[model samples]
Structures are given as C-alpha cells and as structure tokens.
Target: MRKFPFLLTVATIPAAIPAAATAQPVQSLDQVEETVLADDADDADDADATGEVEAITVTATGLFTRIENTGQAVTVIGRDEIEAVQGADITRVLARAPGVAFSRNGPPGAFTGVRVRGGEAEQLLVLIDGVRVADPASPSGGFDFGTLTTGTVGKIDLLRGSNSTIWGSDAIAGVLDISTRGRSGLAGSVEYGARDTLFASATGGLSEDAYFAGLAASFFRTDGFSSAAAGTEADGSEQFTLGGSVFVDLTDQLELFANTRYANSDIDIDGFPAPSYTLGDTSETQETEQLSGALGLAYYGQDLTLRASYALADTARDNFDPALGAAPLFTSDGNSQNLSLRGEYRLIGGLTLAFGGNREWSEYQTDSDTGEDATITGAYVQAGWVLGGLAAHVGARVDDHDRFGSATSFGGDVSYRVGGGWRLRASVGEGFKAPTLYQLYSPYGNLDLQPEQSTSADFGVEHGVRGSDFHAALTLFRRDSENLIGFDNATFTYANIARARAQGIEAELGVDLAPSLRLAGVYSLVDTENRETDNELARRPRHSATLFADWQTPLGLVIGGDLRLVGDSFDNAANTVRLEGYEVFDLRASYPFGDGVELFGRVENVFDEEYQTAAGYGSPGRGAFLGVRAQM
Candidate 1:
C-alpha cells in the first residue's frame, strides 16, 4: 500500500542558479533527499540540511542513480519518519520497508492492500506525477491504497523489484513513484490529533523571467479507532484539497508547464464485522471526487531536453445510503486520459539518451446491479546509458485492449561503479496487465478473462561508508506469474486456475552514530507459491523486519524508537486459516520552544500486539497519539 501526495516537480536551468549553485535550498522533511529520490534512484548525500536538497528534481526514476548508485531494493520515508510514527498510515510507512507486505480493511483508512516480492496486488505499478494511476477498472488490475491521503505528503519513495523496463504496464512487483512539492517558497503547517485528528497545509512559490507559479492546499479529518467488535466504532473520514502549478519561460530554449488538481473525500462507512455489528447490514455513506489536469512543453538546446505531456483524470463515486438490505445502491464513474512525448539527448561524453511515447483512454460507469463499460490504448519506448561510472537501461511496451487482445513487454537495467563507495546492480523485467472492466463485462463476470503476465529478476549490492557515515544494501529477487484471476466460491464468474511463484530477499542498514546518534534497519525474506492450487499464497508472510533508533540530546529533546516484525501467512487460499505472527512497538518524543512551536508525543502498539494480517480483519489494538505543529 503506497500513498503519496506531498508535491514535487522542479524544473530549473535558467541562469544556472545564483552564480554556481548555492541557491537550491529548501529540503527539511527530515532529509535523505526525501527518501532516495522518488522511489529508488538513490545517492544524494547530506547537502548540509536544505536548499531543497540541492535542486531536487526527481519525478521518480528515469534511469538515474545516485543513492550510492541505485542497486535496486529501495526505501525512503521522510517527514521525520512521518513525524515520529504515531498512528502512522500508508501501511505504517510501508512497514518500514523491505520486501513489503500490507493489508488492512479497517482502522486509519481501511481497505488497504499491498504486496511486493510475493507479487499480487495487481503486480504493483503506482505513480502519481509521472502518470499511471492503476485501476483502469479493477478486476484485479490494482491501485486502491485505501483511496489515498497522506495529508499532502512531501516524501515517500519505495521501489523494490521489477520495473518493466522504463515503466509500462504494472511493473510486476515494483515501481512506486510519487512526487510533489515544487511551488518554491512560502511554507505552512498546522496539526491536531487523537481519533478526531485534523491537519492543515499550505505552500507557495513564484518566479519571473517569464513566469512561474505554485500553490497547494490541504485539509483532513478522522474520527476512528477503538473497536473490538460489538457495535463497532472506527469509521469516519473527510478531506479536501487543491493544487496548482504554472511555468512559462520560453526564451533560452522553450519551456511551458501547467497543472491543476482538486480532490474531495467524505466517507462514513460503519460497515464491518459481518454477523451484524448493530444489525447485520453494514452502514454506508460515501462521496469521492477528483479532478486532475496537466499540460507540458519543454525544449532545451545544446544538450537536448525535449518534452510534451497531457493528462486528465476524473473519478467519482457516490452512495448516499445502503445497509445491505437488498444489497444494492450505487453510483460509480471513472475516466482517464493521457498523452506523452519526451526526448533527452546528450550522447557525446557522459552519454545520455531517452525516448518516450504513451497514449491512454479509459472509462467506467455504473447504475446498480454492478455495471461495466470499457476502452483502452497504449504505446511506449525508453532508453538510457552513461559512461564513466557506467550505466545502461532499455524499455519497450505495447498494449491494446478492447477485451484483452493485445499485450507485449520488454525490459533491461544495469549499473556499476564497484569502487570504494561500491555499487553493482542488475535488473531484468517484463510486465503486462490488461483485462479489466470488471473482468470484461461484469454480469456474473468472466468474459473469458486473460491478460496478466510477469517475469522478473534482480541482483543488487550497494555500500557507502567514509569515516563512519554509513549506508548499505543487498537484494535478490525473482518472480513469475501468469493469468491469475480468482473466483470459485459460488460467486460464479472466472477462473484461470491461477499461478504464482515468488522469491525474495532484501536488507538495508543506516548509521550516523555521532552528531546525535542514529541507526536504522530493514530486512525481509519470502517464498510464495501457488503453482495451480498447490496452496500457500494469501496474506504472505515468511519474515519481515524493521528497527530504528534516534536521539538528539542537548536539551531541545528528540528521541525515538521503532520496531516491527511479521511472519506467518495464509488467511485463505485453501491453506485453511493460519494467520499468526506479529510484533510492534513505537515511541517518540519531541520538545522545542524557540517559537515556531513543536511539542510532539507518540506511542503506538507499544507492547500491545494482537495479531492478524487479515483473516478476520480488525486491527489497531494498543494505541496512543499526541500532536502539535505550528509555524506562523
């Protein structure tokens, strides 16, 4: 489960920045270059705090590596680890990453889903700014992250495996690129907590030479948590958002950009715990709205940098009331539009070349008894290479679906440095996913479903340590999937006899030990199978790990702790109930009084660990929260 909405998209080059760099500042969501440059492109050392992480301009990978040379397995969660972990959502920040596995149907924005390495979840491929929003009409095509809301995020990049060449189709178990935050100056913040939590946001920026603008807004609410069955509690939501961006400076070459967004969410679905929470019929009331827009144009001479973009998204869902009496009361709508063109060239010395093409159109509608309607189109191309430190990449794609007739894929990756800071990587990929529209015309579904394919490979190694400023990485992965469509409990629909195979390994480490004391950890191991009903693929858990430590003492306070563990899987998949494995603990502390206001507190699942990765659902046990943030 990955949900990012923090904002970022900076395009700079005019006047080469005040003299020779040194004007690119403005990053402090707790550094690390906002978690490894939008989902694993790695390496961007400290940079003395801010200046916007030295001109940060990562819209999520395009065959670029710096996180010590991107050796695959990536993870980055900033904003001070999401404000010292307290009711931290986004699947608890990807459970502190590593192999990754998430599932939640309740508590803090329920109905969440994520699975990597062990694949599943529409074989992963999520992006917000660089396009691709999944759910072309979920029949298992993925993208739900519980309807997203990380409170106008500012950072989150988790890239684990696969990556269909240069992003095309569901990247088969990998690819999560979400970037936001590029409206220049004017900061803002506000907060309130505990069950009825509240949040506020603001951003600003404006440049001249032709024109540049930026703006952002946010509002949120929650009234949930506390329910162990019986009458039920946890079920409340509210949200509102606005975004903007405009750029035009067609001089030295040519440049133009525009973007807009609006979002709304209001949900009150006290619907859970079947067998009658208050009276069997699960309550429901929802309203979901979204409007998206984008336009782009870029052209730079000398070394080349050509671009074009067009994007549009419209989504709506309204269901005033429904308690499952007759089990039907609906309204659904979806729309998607995209067009792309890109070119980047610098072939001579260091080498750099890129290409792009994309086209998409989608639609969905509903009246009641479950509805359907469809259309789709696609195209792709990509390439990259560099000298000196050595790097290489390739891509390919083809998609045409009226009912799942066309599909094609290609992949590649390579990196090397092998010197002191170390670096070595290898990646192979192939991805494809089509056949949605509720699995081709839902009537009882199954219009001879098909289209679900994947192939993957990974190899990694990374290291950095010069006089004690540590960093590390290690990864190994494999995946194979085919067809995969489920339904066989009398729901009457489809069956492709399923097929899955997964293998995984991920490890990470971090350290700073001095300045104020810091340490980090992540680990994961998995093995999943389903070779056609042989069992073992459900909630997937073979092992998981996460550890953390932070300290900064000299009065101003700032302490932390974090730990997580998971093991034991199989909630269903004919494996006959077997979900046990858990370990959670979190703690935080903050104290500052130099104005800008800051008094934080947190304690989550401290020692209270019940277990269940979704067998009967129902999570959030042992909790605590406290908050305060103001910068006026």
Candidate 2:
C-alpha cells in the first residue's frame, strides 16, 4: 500500500460526519423500552452525572431529534443493557435485535459476519469511538465481529438501512456506531465459562470539572473447539484489547477530545492438505492486529454545534502453515486515515441544518506486493424541521473517488404524531460504495468490479407515547441492490455479478408489568432473493424471533431468560446445501453482595440444542459461565 502524507490533505476535506445523539444511562429493562419510544429532548451527553436512568432518548441524530422524530429503524443498546446481556461476543448481544442474523464458521473466534435485513456484512459501516474500523486489507473491507469483545463498549446505535448521505460510502445496509466506556470511577468484570474459557476486563475513568479521561482493557481465551466438521482437533483462540479516551474543556464552549484502541488476536484455523481438497484440522493459525483512534475539537454554542476531527485505522494480518516452515505463509497490511469538519446549526424557527465534509485515504498490500491506494472526498448536508406534531429530515451527498469517479446519494424521512399513543413514519435512503482495494488489485482481483449501489426504504407505526410503560412497534422494510461484490469461488476471482432484494417485517413489543418485572419480544420475517439466480440469499433465515423476560424477586435475586428461534436456511448461493434450524435458550441470575460488586451466572443452551449456522460448522451446544462485576 502507498504511504503518503494523508494528514497533509486536510484541504481535501468536505462537509461530512456530524455528531449523533449522546446516550443516557439506562437503569432497567423498562427504561430500555422507554428509550425506543421516546425522542424529544437533547441532553447533550445526557448531562446528568447522577448516573441515574433517565428518559431513554435516541440522541444519535445530528439535531438530537428524538426517536419519535426519526423515521429510520433504530436500536440503541446502552451500558445497562450490555451488562444485562453478559457475553464476550458482541454478535450474541446484537442477536437480540430484530432483522439481525449472524454466521460463524465454527466456534467462537472464527470468521463471524452479521447481516442486517438480509444485507451483506460489507454494506455495513462500523464506527468505534468515532473512527471507521473496516479492514482495508480484507476483500470486502468490512469489520469482523469475531474479535470484538463487548467489555470496552459502552453503547451501540444500530440504524438498519441505507443512509450514505450522512455516513458516506459503505452505508448501504446499516451503520453501527459504538462508543467506548465513558463511565466514571472503576468498573470491570472477570468470568470463566465453557471450553475452559477465561475472560476478564477492567475500566477506570476520572471526571474533573473541566476534563474527563478513561482507560479500559480486556482479555479472553478459549480452548477445545474444532473448526472442521469431521476433525477432532481443538482450535483454540486468544485476544486482548487496550483502549483509552480523553476529553478536556479548552474554554467555556470549546472542547478537545481523543481516543485510542488496540487489539491483537491469534486463532487456530483448519485447512485442506495436499491431495485432499477437503476441510480438516491442520497446523494452521491466523494472527490479527488492529488499531483505531481519533482526535478532535468541538465548539458548543447556544444554537450551533461544530466539530473537527482526524482519525486513523490500521489492520495487519498473518497466516502460518506448519507444512510451509515456521514463517508466515501469507501476510497483509492496510490502513485508512480521515479528516472531517461537521456541524449543526439552527437556521430558523423549528428548522435546523447539519453539514459536513470528509476526506479519506485507504490502501492495502499483500505479501506479493499486490497493493493499491485510493482517496475519497465527500460532502453532505441535511435539513430538519419540526412543525407542530410533524417532523421531517432530508439529506444529500456527493462523493469523488480517485478510482471510481463521482456519485450522488439522497435520503428523506418523516414522522407524524397521530391521535392517542400512535405515531406514523416512513423513510427512504440510497447508498453508493466503491470496490475495495483488495477486490480490485489482488491476485484474485477483478479489474471490472463495479461499485455497489442500493436503495432502502421503510414504513412503520408505533405505540409508547406519553411515557407509557407498554411499548410496541411494527416496521416494514425493503432493499434492492445492484452490482453486489462477491468472491467467485468457481473461477477463483472477485466479481460484481450479483443483484438482490430483501424485504422484511419487524415487530417488537415490550411491557413493564411492574417495577420488578419486564418482558420484551421481537420477530422478523425476512424474504430475500438473488435477482440473478432466483434463490433465497444464503444463510438468511426467513423467520426469526426472540423472547426475553426478567424479574427481580423480593429476596433481591434477579433472574432473566431469553430464547432465540431461527428457521432453516441455505448454505450456498445455489441453495444446494440445506442448513437445519435450531433454538437456543439462556438463563441469567445475579445478586448483589459486596460494595458495588455483583455475582452473576448464566446457563447457555440450557437444553443442549445442537445447531449449525453454517453447513459444516457446528455451534456450541450447552455451556455455563459464572462471574463477578463491579461499578462505582
């Protein structure tokens, strides 16, 4: 990959990303439900240092519009919710949301990808601490969920549809914006579970009158899982991460902030030996290292919020084969650097404007010196209006890629409050993403690969207005995509030869039966098809549902359980391999004892239901974990 003075190209920056709504601490499942239904106020970082659960607000919007004001399908997972669903893997936690499906090659630490509304992983844009972390070295330039642990994350905002006007390229399917721990004082956890797995994490933060700083670290290791269906060897894995964030007030209305995170992982992989092109356990392993960080300044005025930032993401990978000596058989390195300036300002009565410009440089290189670099400059603007009981927002973006020329995207959404606890909303968004460097220049590269473009729209209705304890919503969504990029294994090359459509309905209901009890349920019916082949998209279930409930007993014992139900799916694009469906149930319990400490345990796959998400790869059956977590 070319090493150039990318930072010096700040002049290339255009109007780009703006701040989303900040998250407020949620204290219970009821509050979590309320957050999804409430969307009216701006807390500016939820300004409440009391650390109490406040009205759930969807604050990730540039103008801090409430959920009721936005037409897009969104789910916000906060720290309390994250802790409630205790798991090292981020994918498992995300599965609780509707229209979310994931596939893992074998056990944990394997190649994991998540598809939203039946959209491919590469179409999702992931941001960690405001830094885009997609691996440029990967053929799809996507972020892998396999190595990301939930410990360091404080919040997750999932927007389930295209909105490239705000996120720029790669926002075809959805956007996952994650923030690291911003909690005050000390907090962390330690746990031991199935497969002799050990996991631990620590986070510490100090908040002064004018400054706040935090540091976090986590380690995980697991053993005894075979990647190959017919193999007997255990493919172990281990990983660790270190991260920190800082915010300092430079003046009455000016603030400076910075964040950094690093992760390293090693996992045993399977391979097919010579003379046998079949999957089997082998002395093969993979190592990955990643780093992401950002630095920025913000000015907060009475009616204007402006921010400027510089961010960088780097990924390095190596694979080793014992039969080929001790040295790595393959290696790759890639990185992306970005500079941007964005802001939101009140234009007039009930009107606001959000605008930004961004310049990004990305490049990747393999061992064979098959390397390339590209730069993209983009600008975007969004206008929002609040008139009486109606709210609307529209946005447009234009981008110029050094290798793919220029493209334009537009999106619009509206929400209206009807009578009685009812709100109606609709949205339409468009996306345009250029081919990744690896897809265009690698050994199996296809020079003719075209950019992936898509359009997504959704209409929905919801109840849970006026702070009602019971909440329910139904959303209908559809997406049509063209020139989708995929690896052509038959010819051992990459191609833009696929077109697809995904249509689905998502329904969710929640009720706070009482202060001590809460129940939530989500269901999705995704109908997906390959327009070119007339087959259902691989690995996407036509039916998926999840049920969850929690109770706090008089004895101070908290118990909770969740069940996931999935329908059958095809393993290959041709739909020849059938993958059976399965259900998994989990039970969790916790009790407070010492100061700021809680003992927690969970029984996963209680019935030991054996399942396979992929054709030959088996999922973990029954497992259990016990741990302790503390917070001040």
Candidate 3:
C-alpha cells in the first residue's frame, strides 16, 4: 500500500523587485549578449519583463543556449547580487534562493548541509569552474558549503529538480554551477566585525586581445561564540583561500583555459555525548584542506563548437583532541579525476544538437576504515529547438559503473509564451545516485544495496508586467525516490530499505517601485515523508520564506534589509524530537567615496533572536561589521 500526505496551504502576498537587480540597475537575470545564430532577435526588447534574456547557459544541456529558452527551472546569481547581500559565507548567500534549505551545525566553519525540494544533501551536484568538487570521503559524498566563500566567484547558476540525465551521478536533485571571476581589473576589501573577526581579500586580473589572467586571495579569522548551547567556552576559526584563472586565444577559433582554487581552514568545536543534548567538556580541533583545478580547450566554428577538458579535486581532513594528547583522533583523504569531450552543432532552422562523454575516477581513504575506489563512464546527447516564443528540449544519458553495472536516465521539457506577459512551462525527469564508496566497502557497508532512483516533475506559470518592473512566478513540483540507503538498526549495516515522496509549491516575486528602491520575496511550502515508517523526513521545514528590500539614496548611499522565516521540523526520523522555527532580520549599508573607494557596515540578527538549525547547537546572535572596499 502507498500513501500520499497533503500539507496545509498557506497564503502569501507577492513582493516586487528582483533580488538580482537590487544592487544595480534593473536588468533581466537571464539577459546575455546574443552571439549564437539561434537567438531570437524579436523578443529582445521584452526580455527584462519576461525573465527572458540572451545569456548562454552550458549546464542546462552541455551547450550554449539562451537561459530563457532552456526548458528548465533555473536562477542566476551574479556578482552584484552577491555583493548586495554582503554575507560572510556561501551558505548565507545561497539560502536566499527559492526552494533552497540549509542547516549548519554551528558557526561559519562548521559542517553545513544544503537540500533542494526536500532531497538529501548528497543528491545535489556541485561544480566549480566545471569541476566536480564533492568530498568522496564524507559520509554523504556532499560538498561542504562552509569551506566556500564568494570573494572569487563571478556568477552562479542553480538548476532545480532532477537533472542527472545531463549532469550524471549525484545530480538526482539538482545542479549548482559556479564561475570564477575572469575579467580585467584590481579589487580589494578589508573588514572588522563583532567577536574580534577580521577579513581581508585582494583580486587582480589582466585581459588583453589574446591573453588573460586573474588571481584572488582572501584571509579570515574570528573568535566565534560557543557551538553548544549553555556553554561558556568560545570556539574560533581561521581560513585562507587562493584562486586563479588563465585563458589563451591560440587562434581565431581555438582557445585554451585553466582554473585553480585552494582553501585551508582550522576550526575549534565542542563535543556531545551520544543520544544526549548536553554539551561535554571535551574540546576538539579540525584542520581541512581542499583543492580543485580544471584545464580545457575549445575550437569554435561558424556553427559548430568542440571542447575537451580534464578536472581534478582533492580534499583532506584531520581531527585532534587537546585533552587526549597530540596524536590525531582521525584523518580522511579523498580525490576525484574527470576527463570529458563534448560538441555542439547547429542544425536546420532553429534546432541544435549536443553530445558529450565523460570518464570519472574517485577514491577515499580514512584512518579507521579501509580505503576504496571506483570508476564510472557515461555518455549523453540532447536536442533543443527555439522558435519565437516556443522552446523545447530532450536529453538522455547512460552510465556504466564498476560496481553497479549500468543505469540510464532521460528528461524533457517544454515552455511557451501565451502573449500578454504570461509564460507556461512543464518538465519531467529521471535521476539516479550510485552507492558511495564508503557505503559499499566500509565495515558496515552492504554489497547488495541497490542504487537510489527518482522521478520528478514540475509545472509553472510566470507573469511579467510589460513596461513595468514587476515579475512573478508560481511553481508546483513533486518527486518520488525509491531504494533510499539508510542504516539498518537490526543488522548494524547499510541497506536500501526506505522510500520517500516530496511535493511542494514555490512562489517568487520581484518589483522595482522606483529607480532607487526595490523589493523581492520568495515563499515555499513543502511536505516530505518516508514511506517505510509513514513519517515526515527529519530536519526539513514545512514552510520557509524571505523578504528583501534595497534603497539607493541621492547621496550615493545604499541600504538593504532581509527578513527570513523558517517553520518547525523534526530532528529525528521517528518525528519524536521537535525543533522550533525562528525568524531573523539583517541590515546593511554602504557609502561611496572618491577614487573607487567605499565604506560599508552590516548588522546581523538585529533582534538577537536565539535560534538553532540543529538541536543543542547555538546559532549566532546580534552582531555588526564594518568594512572598506576599493576597485580599479
């Protein structure tokens, strides 16, 4: 027998002003310079209002196409939007996106988890400069948002829903594609804040007719508050990051490029007894290092393009206990390598075809667990068509894994404009996640576990007021997952014995009231349940919403505020431990000085509302920061 649970419907008023345009002038997030022959020139004038732009997106289909023309639910966050939020970490910035839910154990450097549409953290795929960077050694094979900062990032594109047919592997939920800064210029910033926190960064780049190079580096340190509730001892953290990119134009049609990023951090933490909420006296230290690099070449023809790339990611972590002497308690190392070839050709009329193949190899080793390795090879092909106000896409992929044998996935979507600023779209996709190396080879592993599989669908409608600054969208989505891997209490081993269903509605609105004032809002209502026990998924909020506003004054001053709300959720799978939800308010202001200089300040948790994303963990209270920035 199967059961479908329904959730209460909540009414929310739409607020206006696109969050992406709050920091700068009003512009469509999807707008891109049309360089391809298939671009629609007639609709260029209405791009801003309709959320349609000429920008090219590679993640949607492994080929460059207009973001508005792609039949997928997507959002783009550019540099301006990033700076406008003025967040110290990537998790804070990402939380502003619709349908995104995140939880952190404690402060900025603590372990963090992100999920989309009630999916597990590991189900989402993360790419930095086209290189996969998830830590295979981690229990969930997921990327830690705590280690990432936005100082070197130029743009981010988030594609929601099952996209494994194009991204493969862990893309059972969605894909987060990040691009580093590659333009010419020099920029830097210095900041000081509460808790004796200090941050500084420098970035420089050069772009010539045929050659370009860019570099960025940053340092951060803070004497943070306690990680555990009712604890007096304070934990601290420090991190250093460096990134660089280089591009060479070998010929009019051929180019070569490379990108590299490295991050290192040291953090202090508190310990807790098993199954208890009380904080223990044991103090611990953690050291982490991450590196990612990619090198690629591309040959561009009149109507055809070909590309080849190689990428690598490595991560290591060591934990130590001062009370137990100098010997490390545990250590882990993980690495991944990928080689890919892809091409795109323009067909007759407004049709395009894209195909790609990839080979992936990964390994994980831990001091307490035996090491493991695995390899996978995959190939995919997709077709896209765009004519006037109508767009369509279809793609399929097959992966051959050393342990799981083979699996195939497919997806398709269609979008159409119905005139008078209305657009309708729908999509259905299939995705799969292979068992991680740890889940397959560890002492508690299960060799006979089957890979997790899912089917997801979404229907949406959008309206943009012509000749005005108002845009809104409503989306309905559902996902069904089977063969979910979980620990078996009786056997003390992992097994694929659970199933889940998630359904939700997402609403968003943006409006610019005047040239200097803007407002944006997002709301999501989700209902997720585990089929085996007929209970709600742990730590997933049923309701979440955000409201943001920005104002630019005549005196060259900019002010912004954000209000965020999260509903209650359970902390345990049995739905026995309830966690209370909370709301937080934040404010920021910036003043421009002469000669490319500016002064900025921010206040976080303005009301000092005490809250926790994890039970027994302490979330930050009211805090303030001041900074200066300069660019050329």
**What local distance difference test score does each model get?**
0.63, 0.79, 0.77
TM-score of each: 0.31, 0.90, 0.91
- Full ranking by lDDT: 2, 3, 1
Model 1: which ten-residue window has the lowest total lDDT?
Answer: 13-22
39, model 2: CA deviation in Å?
Answer: 11
Residue 153's C-alpha lDDT in candidate 1? 53
RMSD of 3: 8.4
| Model 3 residue 631 distance off true place after TM-score fit, in angstroms | 0.6
Better of 1 and 3 by lDDT: 3
Shift in Å, residue 132, candidate 1: 18
TM-score of 1: 0.31
Q: What is the C-alpha lDDT profile of model 2 across 1-632, one tens digit per residue?
A: 00011110111122111122223332222232234334322232332321112232222243334566687888777777788888788876888778999998877888888889998887888888767899998878988888799878776778888988888899898888776765567888999999998989998877665666778898999994898877889888998999887766677667677889999989999888667878888889999999998888766665576779899999999999877899999999999999988877765556778888999999999898868999999998888887767878899999998886888989999988896667898999998778999888888887777789999999999875211357688999999999898888787898888999999899988877987898988899999999999999999999999898889999988999989999999989999999888899999999998688999999989999988887777678788999999877
Ranking by TM-score: 3, 2, 1
Candidate 1, superposed: residue stretches over 4 Å from native: 1-73, 76-84, 91-140, 147-169, 172-193, 196-327, 331-417, 426-428, 442-469, 472-516, 519-549, 552-587, 590-600, 603-632
Residues 332-451, candidate 3: write the lDDT tens digits: 999999998876666655676777889999999999977999999999887777777888889899999998789899999887889876788888888898888888888888888778
After aligning candidate 3 to the native by TM-score, how far in Å is the CA of 542 from where it should be? 0.6
Separate clash counts for every candidate:
18, 12, 6
RMSD of 1: 23.2
